[model samples]
Target: MKKIPVYLFLFLLLAGCSLSNVQHNEELEDAIYLIVSDENNDKLSLNSMTTFDWDKAYLFTPYSTQESITEQLGVDFKDPSDIDWRDDIYLLVFLDSDQVIQYAELERQGADFSIGEKQYLTPTDDIINIKHD
Candidate 1:
């Protein structure tokens, strides 16, 4: 009976330690953002894309851009590992100070750009014009 309790305690302790690897960021500190399923969002490399990772997900925070992505390659994400993200465009998510979340896709149409259709978490009466430089 004593060994049973000790094993139970050890199992619980190890399980808690294993759960520590889970990462989650609930706050945003930037005007533009991108979320993807990958670590190393540290901006360690420029234009260096990492391989697809389904084990973990990461979000790019506080990003702004002057250029844009005008076109997007149609993808069904059938094989997430094989999905090719648009290098010229980004799915910029705007989280206003009011915590109003808007989904916008930035596209680079030559020298000009456009923001994708706006979406909201809840119904809002205000116009959402999420612009970037």
Candidate 2:
């Protein structure tokens, strides 16, 4: 009947909505943070995952934080943000702690980064290690 078809369409549309209904903590199962090592090999803890600066990719540091750059690495593991650290530096992407690397590639923009998001991940492996790359 027409009533049945109309109800089905409405249900499908509502299900497809992309708006977030959960809090930030619920969105991220594990806290995300970045570990940065400066040119002098001084490691810094950038408590946020800031976006990559496509514009200043090579000019200077990508991340500018209100917190001092001298702040030591490693947070309490109960924080989340949208900032990351970059410059003439090396970056390590950690999920919860230094032991677990979310991005296992040695280099941040390594070749493994080219793999499709879904294809590069396995449900059974919480952490992935790329050896051949």
Which stretches of model 2 miss by more than 4 angstroms?
1-30, 34-118, 129-133
**Per-residue lDDT over 83-112 for candidate 2, one digit per residue giving the tens place of the 0 to 100 score:** 244432222333332222222112333212
lDDT assessment of candidate 2: 0.27
| TM-score (all chains, Cα) for each model | 0.23, 0.19
Give the least accurate 10-residue stretch of model 1, judged by summed lDDT.
68-77
Best by lDDT: 1
Q: List the residue pairs that clash in candidate 2.
A: 48-83, 49-82, 49-83, 50-82, 50-83, 50-84
18-89 in candidate 1: lDDT tens per residue? 644322222321212342212223222211222212211111112322221111212111111111343444
- Model 1 regions lying over 4 Å from their true place: 1-4, 24-133
Per-residue lDDT for 45 in model 1? Answer: 20
